[model samples]
Target: MNKSYDLIAVSPHPDDAEIGCGGTLALLSEMGYRIAIVDLTNGEPTPFNDNPQVRIDESLKAANILGIERVTLDLPNRELLDNIEARMKLAKVFRKMRPKIVIGMQGMTPKASPDHYQSQLIFDASVFYSRLSKWEHLFDGMKPWRIHHIFYYYTARELFTQAQPMQFTINISKHFETKKKALLAYESQFRAHPSYNPPIIEWIEGMGRYFGSLVGCAYAEIFYGSTILELNLFKQILG
Candidate 1:
């Protein structure tokens, strides 16, 4: 709420954004876009991460790696509910940040985490509610704001067999290493996992390369959007 952001990425937990779209975020940040991440939860109560403060610190580290701001909501993890209250809370953030574009997780997931879908619902509702003038009182005196676009990023654990096709791919080959550094900030979640047989970072990098192959890049991240994106200039689409 300190300053307006050009983009805002909403994450179900502290590390979700880093895992999902860190490379894109880093690229945007490097391009001088004011961006921030809103974490729905501190991502606590895990098998390795019991202390909430540690997770918070790790999230800040990740945000630093991406050179963006990070905000954490006080919603309960693993039991996030997509209700009016949650929508209102996120709407306030939307109004405060006044982002031109908003990004969030794809609601359709065959995974066990209800938090992911709930977070998506909250983001979808909040984007609409933020534009309502009547919600001025609810948003703590902030003016109504409308987001121009919404994009969805994928997480590594999603059941890709039933996943939706990506609308576009961002060539993050230049920023893939930066993304890995940001993800590694979550030591408790990745490095400290009990069954850390397969390195999560390696798998994520491999996935990025695989996605890049589809678009003839070294490494990339995929995104989906319901609305068609209009290109103003041919040069913009070249990159």
Candidate 2:
């Protein structure tokens, strides 16, 4: 049997998870939840870097910093499509890992790579595909296992996107530094990248601060849920 995880985040590239929900992942790990990140692509051939191994090593280092496991799919970067093959590949991982919660990338980024939106579609289809019975052949003989929850983390690239009324913000105030370190691990993309004018790190930190303010925390991340969330009591809202 494949190793099980309590949660899994589907990322379009190596740094996508770190950018979207790294602090939350770090906090969850500290809470003792078994979590992993599945990167759809290696995030290669950028303007500043051409060596794929560098990106791979960086991703592993970031995963280590976050106290989580990392799995990089062989899917093509910059050319990711929401097709059957892509869906099957991810569905296989969902079947094997058997995550109770699957967090995926949300929103479209017209200024960034189109892979983000495609990855979202793939994540959606793969979630459904993972629960289909008698499709063992398609998933390498793995048995059907339904994921109980699904959520979305923003890429921080959508300019005018607004959070839904049911959307929730996770307080990552304690683990905010850990999230910064995890992002710094990808030096090739962040600190060393020349084309980023206003500096990417600052932009990310600004988003964190903005979200944190919403929840009255030092730092937080926003997530969208597929279903309505239930509160046990009125006091739960106080947090």
Tens-digit lDDT string for candidate 2 (1-239): 27789999999999998888999999999999999999999988777777999999999999999999999999999999999999999999999999999999987888888888899999999999999998998777899989989999986765335465568889998988999999999888887854673467787888999999988998889998886667775687675
Error of 1 at 92 (Å): 0.3
**Which regions of candidate 2 are displaced past 4 Å?**
159-165, 194-198
Candidate 1 segments exceeding 4 Å error = 160-166, 194-197, 232-239
Each model's lDDT: 0.85, 0.89
